[model samples]
Each structure stands twice: as C-alpha cells, then as structure tokens.
Target: ALAYAAQAFQIPCVVVIREDAQLTKLQAIRRYGAEIVLVPLAEWQQRLELEQQRRNLHLVHPFDDPAVAAGQGTVGLEILDAIPDLRTLIVPVGGGGLIAGIAVAIKAQRPNLRIIGVEPEGAPVVSESLAAGHPVAPSRLDSIADGLGAPYTRAFNLSLIERFVDQMRTVSDDAIIEALKAVAQQAKLVVEPAGAAAVAALLADAEIERPVAAVLSGGNVDMDRLGSWLTR
Candidate 1:
C-alpha cells in the first residue's frame, strides 16, 4: 500500500524482495509500476550498485525511513477520525515502524489510549531488542508470518517504541493461524499471518480493554498456498 501511494505521484520505485516472498505481494508491487528484484538474501551488493549509479536516488528503507514512519502514522489519524472513543490499539510489529508511528500519533492526541504491539513468536525482534536495551538479531527465525520476518529492528525505531508503546507481546504461529481463520470466518477478513498477529493476541486468553482497534495490516497471502493452509 505504501508503494502504491508513492506510485500515485509517479515516483519511480524499485522494490527488493526475498526470492521466496509471497507471489501476491510481488504481483501487487509490479502492478503499481515499481521495478522488482528477487534476491536470495541480504543484497547489499546490489544496493551499492545503486549508490554508484546515484541518479539522485534515495534508497527507501521500508520501515526505518522517517517519511515512511510518518506516512504510516496516518492510519492512527484515520482511526481516531472514525472512532474518537477508541481506548486501545493492537498493532503487529515487524521492524516496529507501524506501531511506533501509530503510538506517536495516537498518544499525542489521547495520551491515555493504550497501544500494544504483537509479533510472531519466531521473530521477537522488538521485544528482544527492548530486553537487551539495544537491537538484537535472531540467528534463526522460523515462522509462517513471513511479513513479520524482519531480522532486526533499527535503533531509531527501537527508541521510538521504548518511548511511545505501552506493551509488546508475542504469539505463536499456531495462534496466528487460528486468528487468520477467525478473521476469515467471523470478520470476513482474509489476512496474512503477520496481519493476523494482533488479532492472534486478541484471540488468546488475553486481558484486553474494550473499545480496542486491532490493525489488520495486510492481506497478500500467496494464492497457491492459501487454500491448503486455510484448510489445515
């Protein structure tokens, strides 16, 4: 959606994804007119090539860019506009961009509103980072929530979470799968695992306050695997 927003202004963009990334997400990025590159792993070499070419290009880090974070905060603004009396927000954390920005925006307006974050148990980047008082990367991450598979969080994003967020939680892949089904059956939302992370927390034996808004972040499930996964 962020890339789509950029393309609306005719801003040429190039997106890099893992070779195994969801086909639905890749196709959507291409549909927005952005160039796509599928890499095997961290392709810093290709990034260096872009720097050499320069072309006045600013490499947009997906979640660490200040502009990107601010842009994401608009979701919080929209939610407040629609539900002024909302008391809590549950957002999925990958690299902490979405929740950090939302916390900043909502807390500025309603300081008392609780802001909670959830991530797949396999990749507890934010929670682990907070615990160590610094960013920490996991050696091996395994989860069905591919969208929440960021290896680590940046220091700036970590600081923002430390300042603004109220709680950080982790849920298992099984929990995410259950939440995905619940959203599909109960809410008619076909969300990816990462998108269902917050809902997963909600579905657990959690002590949550009412008037809560849980952000369903994405729906780009790989159609090829969607049916089998949904059935199981």
Candidate 2:
C-alpha cells in the first residue's frame, strides 16, 4: 500500500526487497508497474547508497523520513482517539519506523502512555542495540519475518527508539507463527510474520499490562507459504 500510495502521488518509488523475498512481492510490484530492487544481504547498505546516488533518488528513510514518520504517527493518533483510556501501545519493530513515529505522536499527546516495541528473536536489532547501549548490526540475519530482518540499525531510528520506546521484547519464530494462526482464526486478518511479532510478544510475555493495543503492520503474505504454514 505504501508503494502504491507513493506511486499514485507521482512519487518515483523503488521497492528494496531482500534477495530471498518470495516471488509474490515481485509479481505484485510488476503488476502494479513499480520498480523493484533486490539487495543481497551482504551488499544491502553499500548497494542502497550507490543506487540512490546513481539514480539521484529522493531518498526517504523508512524510519527517519519526517513525512513517513508523520504518516505512521497518525496510527497512534487514531488509537488514542478510539480508546481514550488506552495506557499502552505495543508496536512491532522492523526498521523502527512505525514504532518511532507512533512513540513520538503518543508521547506528545499522552506523555504517560507506555510504548513497547517487539522484535523477532532471530533478528533483534533494536533489543540488541539497547543492550549494547548503541546500534549494533546483527552478526547473522535469519528470521521468517522478512520485513523485520534488518541487518543493521539506522542511527536515526536508534535515537528515536532510545528516547521514545519504553521497553522492547523479542519472540521466537514458533511464537510468531502461533500468533499468526490466532489472528487468522480470531480476528480473521492475514498478517505477515513481521506484522504478527507484536501479538507474539504479548502472548509470550505475561507481564504486559492490559488495555494494550498492538499494531498489525501489514498483510502482504505469499499464498504458497501461507498454505504451507497453515498445513504445518
């Protein structure tokens, strides 16, 4: 949706997907007439910079882009508006864009509201960064949640997370899968693995407070993988 929206608005956009991303995303981008860039895990950062410079791309940092952040902030605003008494918000952290934006908006309006970030255990950049007291790249990137599999944390995202997020948790792939199934059966929502990380954290961690709302970030899942997962 973000890519479509950007394209619709005449923004020359190119999607950067992991090298191993399923064919579904590729097909969708092709169908939508958008450019797709596949970056190998080893060369992502360098290639990204080179590509941006080569194309003179108007780079929009997923986490640091003010416009994108503001757009994500609207989610926090809507949550507060709908649940006036809401005291906490749980957000899944991939590159930290969504949580950073939500934290900023929620804290600005309700300073006391706690904002938590959830990450996949296999790719816990945010959690590991917090532990190391600085942004640290993961030695190995391995996660079923492709969206959340950022090898390195951006400085801008790290700053926002350090300042705004109250807590962070990491959950395993099995836990994430259970959360996905639960949401499918109960909420009737199809969520990607990264999108369900927050729910997985909530289910795995018993200490979380009630009245907590989690962001189900995206619903783009490969049909073949979804069927395989369901059968498993």
Candidate 3:
C-alpha cells in the first residue's frame, strides 16, 4: 500500500523482501512499481542495511518504524470517525504494529473502548510477549498467514501494545481458513489469512463486545493457492 502511495508521487521505491515469502505479496509490491530485491531469509537484515547505505536511502522498517505506526493509526481514526459508537476494535497482530498504532489512537481518545489483538496460534509472538512482560523470539513460526510470520516482536510496537492494548488472542490455522471463507462468503472480501485473523477471533469466540470493528488489513492472496485455500 505504501509502495503504491509512493508511486503516485513518483517516489523511487525499493522493497527488500525475503526470498521465501509468498509470490502474491511480491506481485503486489511489483504492481506498485517498486524495485524488488529478493534477499535470503537469514541475510535480508544485513542486506537491507547495505542496500540503504548504497543508495543513501532512508530504510523503512515494515512494522517497527514510527512513521509506519502513525500512518497505520489513520485506520483507527477513520474507524472511529465512521462509527462513533464503536466499542471494540479487533485488529490482527503480526509484529503488533497495526494494533499498536490503532491502540494508541483509539485509547488516547476513547480510553474505555476495548482494543483486542488477534494472532495466528502457530506464531503467537505479541501475545506471548505481553504475557512475559517483554519481547521474546519464538524458536519456530509455522502459520498459513505468511504476513504474520514474524518470529518475534520488537520494542517499538511491543511498548505500545503493553501500554494500550486491552487483550491479545490467538486463532488456529483451521479457524483462520474458516474466517477467510466467511469473509469471502459473507463480507464479500477476499482476504488473506493474516487479514482474516481478527475475524477468526470473532468467529471462534462469542465474548467479543458488540459494535466491534475488525480491520481486514491485507488482501494479497496467492491465486495459485486459491483452489486449495477455498477447498481446505
């Protein structure tokens, strides 16, 4: 989305993505006309530094950057503006960036409103960190939601979550798949597993406060996997 935003103003955009990431995400990035660099999973971090240094470009952290958080917070503002009576805000948690941003925005204005975060059961990084009172990297992350496959949560987003988020919940892959189908069937939104995560929480649990707003964050689903995903 940022890449597309940059493209509108003809800003030079370079995206460094893990080589093992899903092709659909890469396609979306490419669609925005960003120079896409495929970096090895282990070497991407170091490569990003070098790439930035080589071009004197300001590196943008996906979910850990302050600007990114501020931008994401607009989603919360929009939701609040559209639904003045919104009581619960359910957002999907990966590195906790989106939820962190929204929590800050909503909690600042509506302190009593609930801020719930949902994560994949296989990669419950933020929830675990909130439980431990600090960030901790899991040894493994195995989830169909590649977008939420961050092995750990960083300080920036974690601090905001620990401060403003009301609760963190996790949903199973099966539940996520169901949520994806439900979104397509009911909401008419074809969302990816990560995008379906918050909806999954609402579907799996009946305790969510009504007048809820769930942010369907991304829609970059692999067309090739559409068959298996819809069927499974």
Number of the top candidate by TM-score?
3
User: Across residues 1-232, which tens digit of lDDT does each residue of candidate 1 receive?
Assistant: 7479679898877776767788899989999887876775466346635643676666677688788788899999999999999988999999889888898999999999999999888989889999999998855478888888887789989999999999899999988988888898899878988899999998884578878889999999987666776788
Q: Give the TM-score of candidate 3.
A: 0.94
Candidate 1 lDDT trough over 10 residues, lowest sum: 43-52
lDDT of each: 0.85, 0.82, 0.87
Please give, for residues 1-232, the per-residue lDDT of candidate 3 as tens digits.
7689789999999988877778888888889899889987567778888999999998888888888998899899999999999999899998888888889999889999998899898888887887788898855588988788776688889999888998888899999999999998898888888899999999887888889889998898887776688887
- What tens digits encode model 2's per-residue C-alpha lDDT throughout 37-155? 99887787777778789998877665657678779999999999999999778899877878888899999989889898988888988888878888888755788988888777767
Q: Where does candidate 2 stray beyond 4 Å?
A: none
Candidate 1 global CA lDDT score: 0.85
Residue-pair clash count for candidate 3: 0
Candidate 3 regions with alpha-carbon error over 4 angstroms: none
lDDT of 2: 0.82
